[model samples]
Target: MRVLAAMSGGVDSAVAAARAHAAGHDVTGVHLALARNPQTFRTGARGCCTLEDSRDARRAADVIGIPFYVWDMAEQFKADVVDDFVAEYAAGRTPNPCLRCNEKIKFEAVLDRAVALGFDAVVTGHHARLGADGLLRRSVDEGKDQSYVLAVLTREQLDRAVFPLGDSTKARVREEAAERGLAVADKPDSHDICFISDGDTQGFLQRQLGDAPGDIVDGRTGERLGSHNGAYGFTVGQRKGLDLRVPAADGRPRYVLSITPVTNTVTVGPREDLEVGVVTASKVIWHGESTSVECDVQLRAHGEVYPATVTIEGDTLTARLTSPARGVAAGQAIVAYQRSADGDIVLGSATITASAPLATARA
Candidate 1:
């Protein structure tokens, strides 16, 4: 089978390509140049689209004796992922850029190109399993499972995708890379957004959207506590950097309860106020024709998956968590799963449109 392995200049992708080649499959390495100015973003021996990373991917492809090329997808990436991120935050929603990138760039744009170019499938280093039934499953390595971010992929996309690292743990992957003599085996994982060099999200937003002053209000009393440079700088559940002078009545720490971009007001309350159970999501995407299912829902990546029943109505989805989850924020992707007789299967995901406070915690 002809496969286009998406190499991100990392150990995982390198090993994935190597394994695919060793398995007697025709494999070609492709590095995505997603950033226009690579130097503006920190490479740090991690992250993709760096000049060093592109060189590393080329070297790895040479080591594995495969043809490799760099595809420039910077324009599409900025329009779809980075711009959408700014717009989501400006509209008071917390957007996941990685998920958006997978949906818009990797699976959609790159995969389309690969298929049109006569490749059978597109492979990546995503830590998610694809079953014979054409369903995406959780990775064996739970700690490194990236199935949550990939929950947005459609059935057709899953049909032509391969995740070679799904069955292996991060440690095992590094070991394999070491055995293969790949240089990035010991590189630390990238933390910040690949395009954001200084790790200053606020500065990036300010550069995109002019600074808009706002007021920070107390959630309970609706009294002004402090002023903020911009509402986009704050996120739900954030506590520090608020610079609020209001003293807590019981001396308990406060957390961000909500962000109202229309009024440019950020509300802060006791941490307990962050608990929520009901979430409404829009732009819902189910893998198949199934509309509704009782499954576990994850509000954020690496967050605990909670028991919930997801009901689809038209283009929206309502997830009622069996128990309240803290820091449930709108604009995040809520991934659903179904508990099969054997274990669990991913249902789909939707962008969180709205969230209502739990009944007991309602103001």
Candidate 2:
């Protein structure tokens, strides 16, 4: 079978490509230039899709004795991932751009094009496994598991997805890269949102959304507490960088309880206000059958997996948390995981539409 390896100029991808070739697959390497204007070369660990990254990918293909090429996916990336990210935040929700990339660009855009061109599958370095049953499962190395992001993929996409590094640990991947004479064996992993040239998300959003003066108010009371240049620059559960001098009467630190984009209001209150008892997940995609079941729901990328009873209705899934979850923000993903003898299986994922207080608390 012919394989198109998505090389990301890192040890994981380089090794993944190498392993694919070693596994007797007819493999070709391609590096996606995702930035609108990629630098001549990558400087530090903050940037992705640098010209240097492209060169590194080509070199890896040479080392692995495979053909290499660069694909310009910048416009598609901006429209699908970056623009969606800004829009979600503008609507008073937190969005994960990486998951968007996996859903829209990597799987949909790349895989569709690959299949059209007669490639059997699109190989990636994501640390998730596509089992013999065609279900997506967690990787052997839990610390580096990336099933959450890839969980958004449908059953058809998983059919043509190949993850060569699912079983290998990151440490062993680096060792293999060094042993294979690949230069990116020690390259630092990219952190935060790759598109953000600077790590400041607020600064990035401010530049795109522009200034709109708004009130930052206490969530409990309607009293105004402070002001902001733009409400789109804030997210729920944010504790610091508020730039407000006001203090609570009890002298306790405040956290962002909610962001109302319609009124351009940022609501602040005590930490307990961030607790969420129920999550309504929209745009749900479940690869499994049963409409209602018990599973582990993970909110953020690195957040704890909590027990949840998820019920699917039409196009959405509403989950009742066994224990309240804090900082449950809208626009983030809620990935469902079912326990299995092999590992935790990715049932599906959804975009969080809203979270409400527990029924018990109201009662």
Candidate 3:
């Protein structure tokens, strides 16, 4: 099989490319240039798709003895992932940029191009598995598992996806990179939002959407607690940076409960208000032929899994969790998984539209 290894200048991707080559696949390393003018700071995971990252990926390909190329996908990426992220935030929703990148760019755009160019599959360094049965499953390294983000991949996309590091731990991956004499063996892993390399999400959004001043009111009392430059700066269950002066009746700190973009308002309340047991989602995509299924629901990347009973009808998905979840936000993913003898199988995912309290939903 001919594989296009999506190298990101990290230890995991380097080893993944090396392993794909060792497996006798005709592998070619390709680093995605996501930014027009890349940031090449040696300042420890400053940015993904940096000029330095592309160089490191090329060096890894040299070590692995595979053909390497840098593909410029910056224009498409900015329009799809980055612009969508700003729009979602402006609509007062907490969007996961990484998930969007995987959904729109990596699997959809890259895989489409790979297939068109006669590559059998696009191999990536994501810590998730695609089994021989064509089911997407959790990786062996649970701590480093990335199934939550990859759940957005459709069945057809999963068929052409290869995750070479799914079976190996990150420790073993780094060791393999060192053995292969890859320069990125000791490089720090990128954890921040790649595009928002400065880590000022609020600042970035303000630049894009401009300042829309709004009142931060109490959810229960509807009393203005404070004011914010933009409602998009806050997320459900966020506590700090609120700069609120209101003291709760229980003398506890307040958390963001909701955001009304139409009204330019952010609502705050006690932490208990954040509890939700039922999630209604839209834009649902299932991996298999089943229209409905029972599975555990994962709300965020690397977050706790909650037992859930999921049912789907067209684009509507309803997930009833056994327990309450905190900080359930709109525009976040609700990934469904089934525990079988084979392991945790990623059944499908949807975009959370709304949530209700455990007691309220059951009532």
TM-score of each: 0.96, 0.97, 0.97
lDDT of each: 0.87, 0.89, 0.90
lDDT of 1 at 338: 74
Q: Which should have the higher lDDT, number 1 or number 3?
A: 3
Candidate 2: minimum summed lDDT over ten consecutive residues — where?
A: 39-48
TM-score of 2: 0.97
Q: Is candidate 1 or candidate 2 better by TM-score?
A: 2
lDDT of 3 by residue, 1-363 (tens): 999999988888889899999999999999999985656455677667888888888999999999999889999999999999999999889999999999999999999999999999999999999888999999999999999999988888988999988888888888888888888899988887888868898999999999899899999888888899999899998999999877777889999999999999999998888999999999887885676666799998888899988999889999988899999999999999989786799989999989998898789
Q: What is the lDDT of residue 105 in candidate 3?
A: 91
Candidate 2 stretches greater than 4 Å from native: 359-363
Model 2 clashing residue pairs (backbone): none
Cα deviation at 10, candidate 1, in Å, is 0.4
